[model samples]
Target: MYIPDIYKNENQEEIQNFIHENSFAILVNQTDGKLWATHIPLILDKNEAGKDILVGHVSKENPQAGSFSENAEVLAIFSGPHTYVSSSWYDHENVPTWNYLAAHIYGKVKVLNHDEAVGSLKKLVDKYEKKSKTPLRVEDLSKKTMMQACGIIAFEIEITSVEAVKKLSQNRDKKNYDNIISELENIGDLNSKQMADEMRKNK
Candidate 1:
């Protein structure tokens, strides 16, 4: 992430919260002398040592499942809302730019055992199912279905570092910043509204 000083976000709580809100991430690794990426939803956990850990599963049929070892290093990218910022929103002349929030997490991958893998799957199911009008719990799955799910591979990533960015026009002057926010809010799309809210919070 090529983040300018103005856009750099060093707030740990904000970064973690962003990760939690955008848990669906892109997991990237190197395999067979080539780079591979997988899109998946990860659950964040904190260890007794207060270190961040990420848990997720990969389909057995996916070749990336075998791309990692016990201590292999990998990256997970968690991206929040983003939108285009028009130069016209600025009080003075400026070029168009983008405003967004994102976190790049680097970690060491640790493959989980069969029981742990099953637990990870259950946790994911429970998290998303709660939003349903009539929640369907993972435990409701039939024995055969559970058996079939065993084919998935589960792993944990022990977080090493985090690089986060919040490009919400912090580099602009107050008048321009306010203008940008107002324009974004008026646009009314989800991404634009999100950018506007972030700008207001940061301001």
Candidate 2:
């Protein structure tokens, strides 16, 4: 994550909130001299010591899961809305650029035991199922369905570093920034609209 000083975001609360909202992240690791990445939902949590951590699991079938061990370093990338910022949006001459928000979390992995793994799975299910018309609980699953849990490897990532980046055209002058937001909203796509909103908040 090579971030310029102007784009670097040091606000801890904002960074954590962004991570939670974009919980589905790319988990990156290396094994056998090969790099691997897995996309999964990682829940934000706190360990017994009250330090922030991430709880998640990967399918045992995923080759990336083969490298999990105590203190293995991993990187989780959480991405948010982004859109192309055409140079035309600027008041003066400038090159086109992309505006987006993202967070990179570097941490050490801690594999969970069987019981702890299942508990984490249960919590994961409960959180996503909460808004369902007929919410389902992990306990509601039959023994055969529950057997699927055995096929996953749960782990916790003790957060060691967080690099938060929000390149929302903060360097632009008021007129250019306002024009960019207006153009983004006029584009009418979900991502562009979201980026416009983010720019407004940042403004």
Candidate 3:
């Protein structure tokens, strides 16, 4: 979250899009004087007051679930494509580094009631199931399936601040930047290809 001026992305719309694309987030909070973390898929949505909030759930068995409270602060991290950037790709001598995009969101946590949780679940299921051959829905689930929800705790976080960083070789000159993209594409891994594509967009 310590983003340099050159790498800091203050574009709220872009940051929101990135969060939606990389919705699987690392949720962190303090528990018993120690930090607790959970990796889960969270969706961005607005609360009844029309403010931005993130919705997600954790299993009741998860110790982190018990830590959620109305006033507790939590952090959610959304990570994007990234890969190693070898100095060999740069024309001038330099050390290897990694290029990536990430967003850190800080918010106040609040546990949601059953009805609100169901509403959130409906939205989550509808969004992800859109691309499926046979889209299923929360309303369509059987009683047994609904009972499974009892094992989890749904919550929402009112977003207080967000820090987005886009470190896509913005410091490199045109020649080195082009070469870096070329090298990444040539590497041909999924991460490399995606990073190459993002670098081009950043350029």
Candidate 4:
């Protein structure tokens, strides 16, 4: 991820929160000299010592997972709010651009078997669904459902590196940033509102 200083997000906690908030991410790897990508929901596990680990699964039919080579690097892209910005929204004449937030996590790939996969499923459910809500009991699932889900392969990626970019009009002057926020607020798109809110927080 190429991030300018103004748009760089260096806070580890903030980056993890962003990934958790937008858990569905694009897993990218190389296969036979070709780049392969699969969209899946991933969870970041924070151990008691505060170490972060990546957990997720892909369908057995999805050949993307088969492409991972030992020591090969994989990238998971977690995308947040994004929207186009019109030059007209700026106080002065400027080229139009897009504002967005994204995180790129690089890790070493390791496939997990049935037992580990089951544990991964449990962790996923626990992370996303609130503990207070009635959780979906995997053991209670029918054999058909269990077999069907178990067929999907699961893996853990030990994140060796990570980067995040928060390009929410950070390069713009305060006046222009404020103008952009005002314009975004009136557009009524949820993404625009999110961008506006991000800009406001940075201000």
Better of 3 and 4 by lDDT: 3
Q: lDDT by residue for model 1 over 1-203, one digit each (tens)?
A: 78898889999888888988899999998876788899999999876688789999999888788878722889999999999999987777879988889999999998899988988888888888888999877778888888977788899999988899988887888999899989998999999998888889888
Give the per-residue lDDT of model 4 (tens digit) for 1-203. Answer: 67778888999889988998999999998876788899999999853457687889988777776676533689999999999999998767889999999999999877888988988887787776676568776667787887876677788888889999998887788888888999999997899999899889878
Task: Name the lDDT value of residue 164 in candidate 2.
Answer: 93
On the 0 to 100 scale, the lDDT of residue 46 in model 2 is 94
**TM-score of each predicted structure versus truth:** 0.95, 0.97, 0.97, 0.90
Cα lDDT of model 3 overall? 0.92
Candidate number achieving the greatest TM-score relative to the actual structure: 3
lDDT of 3 by residue, 1-203 (tens): 68899999999999999999999999999976689889999999998899999999999998888777633899999999999999999888999999999999999988988888888899999989999999998999998889888888999999999999999999999999999999999999999999999999987
- RMSD in Å for model 3: 1.0
TM-score of 1: 0.95
The better candidate by lDDT, 1 or 2, is: 2
Off by over 4 Å in 4: 47-50, 69-71, 131-134
Model 1: runs farther than 4 Å from truth? 48-50
On TM-score, the stronger of 3 and 4 is 3
Each candidate's lDDT (Cα)?
0.88, 0.92, 0.92, 0.85
Model 1, backbone clash pairs (residues 3+ apart or across chains), number: 0
Query: What is candidate 2's CA lDDT for residue 24?
Result: 96
